[model samples]
Target: MVKQANKPTVWFNADEADILEAFSSAVTSTQLIQLIGPSSQLVIIDEAQQIPDIGKKLKLIYDNRPDIQVIATGSSAFDLQSQTAEPLTGRKKTFQLYPISFGETVKDTSRLEAKRLLDSRLIYGLYPEVLNNPGQEKEILIEIAQSYLYKDVLQLDSIRKPSHIEKLLKALAFQVGSEVSYHELAQTIGNIDTATVEKYLDLLEKAFVIFKLPAFNRNLRNEIKKGKKYYFYDNGIRNVLINNFTFPEMRQDKGALWENFLISERLKFNAYQSRFVNTYFWRTHDKAEIDYLEETDGILYAYEFKWKDQKVRFPASFLQSYPEHQTAVVTRQNFEGFLGA
Candidate 1:
């Protein structure tokens, strides 16, 4: 039988100075058990990566106390995953929580209102604080970009110079919709090798700041295979990296911003609803391209994102190769359905 919901729950934040001190001393399983009393039905440990040997400690609790449910959360994937991978292999189930999604905003208000705020969403993004505080988006984004964005990556021993990561992020920010080359990035961020650039990119990805879209090239000889494009998990973060918070109408990269917004929101939409799909960008060496592609259950879906309502024609080469596919152009006027709202 499961524990009833009426029982008490215990919460601990390993980042808090007092909690850190207490956890640092509670080394043994017995000591840890004493710290978390038997009366609690649930134990929640936030910033669990800060606790030493967290995985083994969690395993011990699971082994000893069969009644009490435990939840451990960490902001940084690299630290948390590394610490927990070995000890709590089968004992844990992980879930990723992204920034607030378009569907969620619609739930809070009406779909019409969500559409009305589309420009603001594109400029300021949908982070909880940014959404809650209407006019303070710029200051909040600046703080997040400078203070918390690289907090985890900078702490790693492998990252000796922080400037390289900053430069790499700026370069990625500038090339949001375009294919990125490691050699070119290395040349741009002087004194850094291609290997380090790749490493920093990986770290940023693991940290959930950005995601990569690989080229789809299973069919055509002209399709570019060895190409990758990066998009931020949030548009505001990308803008803050390059210090561009211009309104959508005034910006030159409105199309890129729109593409990033659609892709990221679509990511959150698919994730929340458990729609499993493999994603990519389609491009040919000769410059014909489709902005985004998704393959699900062996069916291809191609999408082209436009900031304004416009007719778009997908590449003929791609259509000929993948004949049995769905295609659509997602525009500002009809983007609500694209984001699963």
Candidate 2:
């Protein structure tokens, strides 16, 4: 978008001293405008969450300067979202960029090439830098996990025990694709309470480290909705948290890993394509389950992820209940179509 725009653009890092100076009380809007000059038509601030009053600053720029379009980017939703919520309400649009999706990653590749890259992608994830670096995926993923992943969460004043957060994430890594219990999480991470466990999980979610898939429940007495399943935004980060990068054949949790990868990719695909849908996992007291479910436009879509191609049918209870719903098993052979790749 930036490259295609015909107007001159000015870029600013919110952490820079001069950018902060521009937002100071002493500097009038006119002075800041003069500093930017007339030709600068767009202003982009990266890591906008670093500035405490970024939303106010952006609101000022938006209200005062009609000619300059502003775009702000932040790594942590908790920081930038809260700071911008009231100030930019109805005045700004928001976009979230997740790790590169399968469609974007393989846009120009052949089916053979995509197949060749599948194993690596499943293990190391689709981070842009990881894709570009190729053979150094482990190093890149570890660096991202240790250095950049939790940086924003750690900076938040509410999170006092950073070590506990790390332990909490490691426990979550082991429980992907399964319902998580806050009480069990608290027990796993010593010195933390159930409330703290919930708070930390919320913090991790807002920071974009993880996302929860709530249970799909109708009014049926047997439907499950008491717990939620959490999945990482990136498979590589999850693997790094667990400190395991073994090949699929050598790993006992390959099925769970495949499920996580597919769900995460589908999420990115949906978000990027602006496909509005409510997502969840469906299970009943009798253990009849579907791995992923989507409700969109008054229609129910149920999907099961399989590492190998296999014929499967919808749960009998679900079919008896909602026979009009669509059901499909997404496997290695046809996942590209499922993810819109």
Candidate 3:
């Protein structure tokens, strides 16, 4: 729930706080006003997607009552928007509260503790239950997918078939941080069009399940026109779906996944920390690719993610073009320095 300045943070702790079930069958403004308590300023409805005509209802509430701040919390807002996008136009503010951010896991936790928890996050994912009791991982994951993931997908026309969606998710889990071809994905899941594939992927994005990063488009459009990369919101979720939750040392692709996950976490950190910046990945036709390209004002920050501590060589062509850009090596040995800097 979004924090309301008028109300105390903890409802139960406050003397004036009164949490009422604002859910109502009120069709008119009079009925809507009657549902909410007179003193109530902040309205928080959990599982808001369950409400019938959610978007229209929200818009009505927001429009009718300017005094009350409506903050509807739902794991799947996609359904609400699908029901009616116009009803809630320019009224509600959408904020994504993911399972748990990478920064959250390591905030107060010791480095050793963080590493210990990473394996569980890698496999079962950072979904509340799996992060809590990792033993019942498979059960929790399947339940989460069936309960929340399926509910929205089933409602969407693009993904009428649940089995195909599951198969697509499983296939994409292995291809984390890699460009996904819609045509190839459709072919793998039997008969489906590329547009359908794109639509299904969009549904996932809308639900905050996965994030797709478009290839950076500069004047060199041919270099980036090929394919866009897809990444799971949580590294743990990605690992779990792929069935590759081996120990860091034993897992060959662990480094790659970790790097990918860290990049996302860092991006999250920047956003949450209120830093103004943009992200990109620069690549040339000759196969020269820079992992991350961040631009703040006219200044550019280029990063290369590698597991090894060995030296990295930036392309001479890139230096000739953007000599002012800052380049750095992020590896096991130097990552701490990068973070500190």
Candidate 4:
């Protein structure tokens, strides 16, 4: 974006306590402008969430200086959004960036290479570092999952029992590709209430650890609408939680893993392309279900995931109710289009 704007760039690390304190302690926007000096076209702030009152500060700079554009980035949105929500309401545009997507990777590689890398990607995930450092993918993923992913959330005041956060993550990890019960999760975690479980899950999502897909329903009596299914933003992190990084062929939950991989990559594609859509999973009391459902522009697109060749039939009741929608089976044979690859 800096290069495209044809502007000289100035960068700052908000994570540095000295710089953040000094900059934020400035009395006014005029002082900030003087501190930044002249001829600065673009100002990029890394880990912007760490600095208190950063949103207001950025807004001050933005309102005062029309020539300079500001870009703020952080690992977690929980802090950043809370601080920026009201202050930068009209001044900012927020984006959620995940690991590399299939749509992006395919652009640089041939179809055959993409196919060959599918298993490795599904196992180790699409993190840029993991994708680039072939020999150290496991180490990198473990370090990220343990040390980097939850750093922002852990620092928040709302988190009292930090250890429970990891426990909740592990429970969610085990239940991937399946509907989650908050009550059941609370029971499993012992001494924690259902509300805390929910809060932790929300924090995890804001920290980019997991995302929930709510059940899709049309108010049908038998339609399951109360629960939600959670998936890790990265399979490598999920694997770290479960402590299993075996080859896909040796894993019994290959289908579930494949589903997680596809859904996450699909999400990344949707986000990067700015395809605004409401996503969900559909199921009925009688066990009829679709793995993924996406609604866009008042049109429903349903997908059932399969790691291998299998006969997948859409629920008859779903077809009868939503005849205007489209349904397709996604599998290894023809998943490229489904993933926008």
Candidate 1 lDDT, tens digit per residue, 1-341?
13346677788988899887887788787888888876777888989999888888888888888687898998776788889989988888888889999899899999889888988998889899999998899999998887767666788546788898889999999999999999999999999999988988888888889999999989788889899999999999988888888889999999889999999999998888899999999999899999999999889999998877888888788888998799999998898888888
Q: Which is superior by TM-score, 2 or 3?
A: 2
Model 3 worst lDDT run, 10 consecutive residues:
8-17
Instruction: State the local distance difference test value for candidate 4.
Output: 0.85
Tens-digit per-residue lDDT, 251-289, candidate 2: 899988999999998998899888999999999989999
How high is each candidate's TM-score?
A: 0.96, 0.94, 0.83, 0.95
List clashing residue pairs in candidate 4.
none
Weakest lDDT window of 10 consecutive positions for candidate 4: 1-10
List runs of model 2 lying over 4 Å from the truth. Answer: 1-5, 25-27
Best by lDDT: 1
lDDT of 2: 0.84
lDDT of 4 by residue, 83-166 (tens): 888988888888777888877778878788988889888888888999889899889988887676556568765677777887
Question: Which is the better candidate, 3 or 4, if ranked by lDDT?
Answer: 4
Each prediction's Cα lDDT score?
0.88, 0.84, 0.67, 0.85
- Residue-wise lDDT of candidate 3 within 66-138, one digit each (tens)? 8777666655567655654678777766665656664566675765676566555555566667777757877
Identify the leading candidate in terms of TM-score.
1
Best of the two (1, 3) by TM-score: 1
Rate residue 169 of model 4 by lDDT.
Answer: 85
Model 3 TM-score, 2 decimals: 0.83
Count clashing pairs, candidate 4: 0
